[model samples]
Target chain A: MIIAMASGKGGTGKTTLSVNLAKAFSQPVQLLDCDVEEPNDHLFLGGELLNETIVSVLVPEVDASRCDGCRACSAFCRYNAIIVPGKTALVFPELCHSCGGCIKVCPQNALKEVEQRIGLIRTWRSGGISLLQGQLDVGVASAPPLIRVLKERIEPDRIVILDAPPGTSCPVVTTLRGADLALLVTEPTPFGLHDLTIAVEMVREINLPMAVIVNRMGIGDDRVQRFCQAENIPVIAEIMDDRRIAENYSRGLAAIDHVPGFRAVMIELRDKITALCRKEA
Target chain B: MKIAFSTSGSNLDAPLDSRFGRCASFLIYDLETDQFEIISNLQNLTAAQGAGIQAAETVVRSGAQALITGHCGPKAFKVLSAAGVTVYNAAEGTVHAALNAYKAGQLPPTSSADVEGHWS
Candidate 1:
């Protein structure tokens, strides 16, 4: 079964829960960190490097010799990536969506697709878990393509856990696609509840089964729990606000190994996720 | 010579629109014929992105030799420069006044974009 861990707000413990849960699972697990912008799961794993793969996206390259400045390519591009000013076409690779519509529409056949390096996917092994994470190149505006490439490395036989990026944008949706369940990690504050509501709506729009895991459960009011109860969404697990867990996290230590009672919490959470996945299946 | 002025209204009497990319309209005036026409920029005004590049394409395709606006962005400036179209910084007044200033050679030609891209 594939479980995607996501959060509407940043620093809400998506990474924390994902690493701990992966460590708690008894069988071998495949953890994919789909947060290409800033992947930090490797910091906690401290594993040996397995392999690296370069991820690239196709962008348009204009041929100045065969171009007659017909403006057809520019007219067909929705992103305005290609423009014909005078007698040749100019391509802004960063703006190109890699749709290849401009090449199809080019009457002069001046546009060609070329690969541009967008990011890197690195695989590592820590104990029974194999972690693959994508790190997007700086200044790249898009992250979904890299995340898609990372998700393709998911091992079908092993239990997979996807650590998705924050928010309900395209990147998160890309990670959540084709997952058995979406495990939304959030806090108990009003801010968490507000963004969590938006995230729930997004998940519902995609028709995905979802459950909530409330982290830092001691400080804020029970509004998040109440909201989940009202919405018929299950609050599967709650990790209390503990300074020791925070300290272990700061030291790049997995809560399952360092914290005293965190192992039981992760075990229970893993069992609940397994049950939910079974029900979903 | 034909010159384009980014304007808030359709006529030459209207004030110059400071924003070049998302301007309301463009007033194209011919120096020799003393005739002018207004091109609505509504399509680019509501564009999600690349408004500056598209707006520059509009000016270049109009066969205008010069563009008069309050500020230009890097992309738009690059397009205009590639098309050999001179960009003149317009004064804070009506299109008619900017036209007079251009005719008098009072408005200076910009070497580069004064404002960054996506400046609203």
Candidate 2:
């Protein structure tokens, strides 16, 4: 079963919950960091780099010699990546969405598609858990493509835990689309509640069974709990506000390592998640 | 020489839209013919990304030598400047007023983008 841990607000402990939960399982598990823009799960896991793959997107390249000043490719390109002025077609790879419409519509056959490196996918193993992460190149606007590429590599036999990027945008949507359950990690602050509401709506739209985990439980009021109760969403667990957990996190250590009793908390959380998945099955 | 102004309405009396990429319409005026035409910018307004670059390409395709808009982004400015199109700042007023200002050379030509990308 695939479980996606997501949070609408950044710094809400999606990675923390995902990493610790993956480590809690005695059986081999798969941990996928779908936050391609900045994959930090490797920092907490501290595993050896097993394999790496570079991902590329096809962008249009124009040959001005064979082209007339017809502007056909420019007119056909929805992204406006191609600009045809007089006798040349200027291609902006950054703006290209890799749709290849410009090359198909070129009347003179002057356009050709070229591969442009967009991101990387790396796999690592530390103990029974195998970690896969997608790392998008800097200045690349799109992450959904890389996330899709990474999700395709998920092993079906093992239990998969996905660490989704923050927000209800395209990347998050792509990460949680096919998951068996969504584990929304949130805080008790107003910003947390506001964004959690958005995240819940997104999960509902995607038609996934989900529950909530309120991180930093003591930092704010009980409004998040009240809201969750009113919405009939289950609060699976709450990680109390502890300075030791924060210190361990800052030092790239999981709560299970430095904070006492945290291991049991994560183990119980993992069992609850397993039960939820079984209920769905 | 021909000039283009980002306008909210079809006629010369429309207000000058501050947004370049998401402008409702564009007014293209020819100095030799003394005639103007309004083209609706529906596609770029609804574009999720690259709207500025798309709008710039449309203006360049219209054969306009000068553009009068409230702001221009770096990417759009590069596209326009590469096509030898001079950019001018559109003052706060109707499209007709902006046209008159351009006629009187009151609008200054910009060497760089006045606003960052995706300003709207």
Q: Who wins the lDDT comparison?
A: 1
- Candidate with maximal TM-score: 1
- Candidates 1 onward: DockQ, in order: 0.74, 0.47
> Tens digits of per-residue lDDT for model 1 on A1-281?
99999989888999999999999988999999999999999999999999999999998888889999988999988787889889998887878878989989888888888999999999999999999999999989899989988988888778999999999999999999899899888999999999999999999987899999999989889999999999999999988999888898899989889888889999999999999989988
The ten-residue window of minimal lDDT in model 2 chain A covers A78-87
By summed lDDT, which 10 consecutive residues of candidate 1 chain A come out lowest?
A: A89-98
For model 2, the superposed segments whose C-alpha errors exceed 4 Å read A69-72, B9-16, B90-112
Tens digit per residue, CA lDDT, model 1, B1-120 = 999999989987899999999999899999999999998888997887889899999999899999999999998998999999999987689999999999898998999999988777
Cα lDDT, model 1, residue A223: 97
Q: What is the per-residue lDDT of model 2 for residues B4-120, given as tens digits with 9 covering 90 to 100?
A: 999889888889998898899889999899899988898887887778888887898899999999899988888888888999987679988998898898888999999888776
TM-score of chain A of 1: 0.98
Error of 2 at B6 (Å): 2.6
